[model samples]
Target: MDSRRAFLKKTLISGTGMALSGSLMPQSLLAASSKKITILHTNDMHSRIEPFPDDGGTFANMGGMARRATLISEIRAKEPNVLLLDAGDIFQGTPYFNFYGGELEFKLMSKMKYDAATLGNHDFDNGMDGLLGQLPNASFNFISSNYDFSDTLLHNQFSAYKIFNKGGIKIGVFGLGIELEGLVAKENYGNTKYLDPIAVSREMVQQLKNKKCDLIICLSHLGYSYQSQKIDDRKLAAQVNGIDLIIGGHTHTFLDHPEEIINKDGHKTLINQVGWSGLKLGKIDFAFGKKNEISYANSEPLAII
Candidate 1:
């Protein structure tokens, strides 16, 4: 008789627990308490190891690699979920690149702990051989969804995409380069096939989404806009979907903040660029709150001067 009574009591308790659990809050509600993410990015640094000389130009005495390093370190110290990234054109500006053939550029960027970078037209100044020679110095990876390097020295050095995990949030980053037919010499980008950026970008975004990335970013050497009908960042954003941000280069455009555009799926996409020559460092703070939603986005352009 005692055993029968206990069994009935246990059944009632289990039913009550199941009923309560059925009304439990969703996972997003639990994510309401979490840390945020900050993304620091740059483009077209072009080997400007030191600040531009005090020649009375607009950017004179502004933009030195050391200053950028300090700024990045300070941010990382304060924010555990910080990502430092670059677009392209990491080489071929100052006497350093001319003298050392891109070795110093990779070394400095590695020191700065750049997560990933794309290829720029100017990166091929000394040809594929020169780029391959300096590849060993880079601690970070290279990403490019397009620009097939089959049958070339760079065939295995570059990856199509990479994923970074921070604070339980996943960020998928990829790269896209401009068409090389007219921009680069045949011998410079030898055996490299330039695929359609729009198509390649779509594929990458789908893959990133499959990986359940909270953020998807593209580092592109395509310019911001074009007077002609040539495809640029703006057009690319409109044509594609699932890319959260595009850090652009090649036109050296300076933007104080990111431009928001509606994508094919009608979602907001952001595009940002800092002028070339390492004159500006672009910083964007994205606060991820409940449900991994971006509660705030703040972008600042740092003057090297």
Candidate 2:
């Protein structure tokens, strides 16, 4: 891996691109078919079926699945193409998880029409069989590009990437999970091989590019930036090219807006994470027109009130 500065310098010389990469707009949200798309995303929801009580605290009376559904419905009513995504940690936390063991979570997300989600360390709380047992409840796809579940019960439960067609725009989406060694118990994730995120990302990006996708998104449970050497969303962005945006979780960091980074190819990628507990829904509106023509890629934090 080259130093970021060195990579940036080579990119400049070879015209690998400084703003956008590979003959395409990096952060496109709209397609040229006179259609607009809305991306609705959440992360680390942690089974909060109901909002927090009005306990006179920071999250008082906020983050209920009902409110989130209403908001999503409203958006779908207005937008022609909308994609709802979650970045894992859909299990555990609240009493609902303790009582229902994630059935309700999957059912609710299915009812809300979630497009896809990734895996988080906590999703393995009850072990592989536990998660495999609950798979029948989720209507959406689970994508984990780096977690090799070939030897586990989850072998047939997920795919590495999914391509979406929205208003004529082909969007390539994949998932990446955090390393689970210190995070999850050994028995819980038995025989699930952890692949190198960077390598997997590189491969997935090439596949997506070959598929000729207009935009690429990563549903990541790898958290946001960390001060330590622990790999995070920032590292993913800096190392890989072709991923247009990253919807992240695991760290529970709240951002007023998405963070932008220049990738290995010198293209821009946006990283966004709404605070956990379903209190806030991340909304980004995209308009696509003309090849290689850049759009401002809207990033708005929509409160589910």
Candidate 3:
């Protein structure tokens, strides 16, 4: 147990390719002068309520909701300022969604105390009415900045963005979903207009900045990267400004650590995505200085064993 903790601590402190703009302060001074916030995230859960069976598979006996809950609880017990988030696809994969229709997933996420989550293409598998039916089970906020649900049954059901104040540090989180036209069946996402992600992201950033948020995060369901000119997380990070971190999903990209991309303003935007089926959890720690500026940041992807 001690060795495991040591391994996690080492991984967290020794994150590679982390982008920083300013000089880093001494550890002791930073600890005294800055406040630390730990962000824990997951993506593309796809209704894996229980861990994979031990059938000699790659992810066998891994990624159960119970284990995730225990791990999250342990972390929350140690860290006072912690945010738990998800980048969508919380529905449709296993038989659970077929039987429960996302009710179980939302209830479990609520049980795990998810702060916010976005929508994914697969999330619309059961259709708009299917998703709306399970909304009563979720306790957290569903943020979707780009997906316009004004003309659908889901109108006014989701927030464009949400601001959270954790220990006097203001954190703004918005969400962006993929273009669901061809991806999703037209009837599934009926009347839900897909807005331009880049444009919406810029607007969200400006609004969040105007609100004086210390940290800005985007819960993105737009896959990590793409070969063509698709607006994935990487493109969004490079094109949009003021988004400090983007927790992403889709394409099931397995990342050991967060990837850093320089935005239009030359500032660093970190993009992270864990593979599907709740196999891993992405964790990032940010330290804010007295002026509410991010002094340091690091990340690690925790394997759900």
Candidate 4:
């Protein structure tokens, strides 16, 4: 065990651009009764179906769906338990969205086999009807806890939360969207009621706990932070308990590492976000003990080269 710990410490220190966080237990300590889950996530893709042109811009020739797909495939080939998720803004930005109304984007994500996604304000750029029209192109679910679509055409189209069993470990995931009133046009998101994220998060935690999930994740479209009183991922992490991780979007913040914040119950919650346009894919590996308790976690953002 001591040798394993020393090895892990040395590897971490030698690893470039890797941020080792959370409670870490040496792999040897739990090798006989441990499982590891790798979470691959993205945010604010905004309809970037192809790589940026080699036009000498900052992100020139950087982000592309094809590169991301190849990277994800490579990881899945090596990892037994993996989850691919998005924090939303899947539509609106490139000419592709304008031409196809998000059909191409959804199709590509479906091809990549995304497990789930949340809603971003820009997702409503073409309105609810447009979003509904492209639903058939997607193979995965959309989970949004705070946005009530009861009276819209999107009623019952999304889940408040979903549970998954990966390698005998139960993982719970829920979603939260930014308030769309002013950011989104009234006609675009007609009749969709925005609920309080904090309140909904507390309820989700209790419900997932009752369901005996070992890990709970929040797919949040809330911005990373704000000077004003607007609720952001950081604020949500500080106020809520029981959320193991918060995958954030909407502000297009590029975080090289996941920020660890102690929550209301004094438990640690991790928050991470990659900038918009599919430039980077955030990866977090969590190791669980025999009892499904998280023993170790580490994060790194893989650039889509």
The clash numbers for all candidates, in the given order, read 2, 5, 0, 0
Which pairs, if any, clash in model 3? Answer: none
Q: Find the 10 residues in a row with the least total lDDT in model 2.
A: 15-24
Q: Over the stretch 1-305, how does candidate 4's per-residue lDDT look in tens digits?
A: 54323433342344311234543655455344458889999999998877888899999989788778879989999888999999999998988888878877887787788999999999999899999988887889899999999999999999999999998899999999999988999999999999999999999999999999999999999999899999999999999989999999999999988988886578888899999999999999888876889877878799987
**Which parts of model 2 are misplaced by more than 4 Å?**
1-33, 292-294
Tens-digit lDDT track of model 1 for 21-57: 1213343543343756778888898888777888998
lDDT of candidate 3 over 52-102, digit per residue (tens): 989999899998877787799898997889999999999988898998798
Ranking by lDDT: 4, 3, 2, 1
Q: Candidate 2, 209: how far from true, in Å?
A: 0.7
Minimal lDDT window, size 10, model 4: 10-19
Clashing pairs in 4: none
**lDDT at position 97, candidate 1:** 82
Model 4, C-alpha of 280: deviation from truth (Å): 0.3
| Candidate 1 TM-score versus the reference | 0.87
* Model with the higher lDDT, candidate 1 or 3: 3
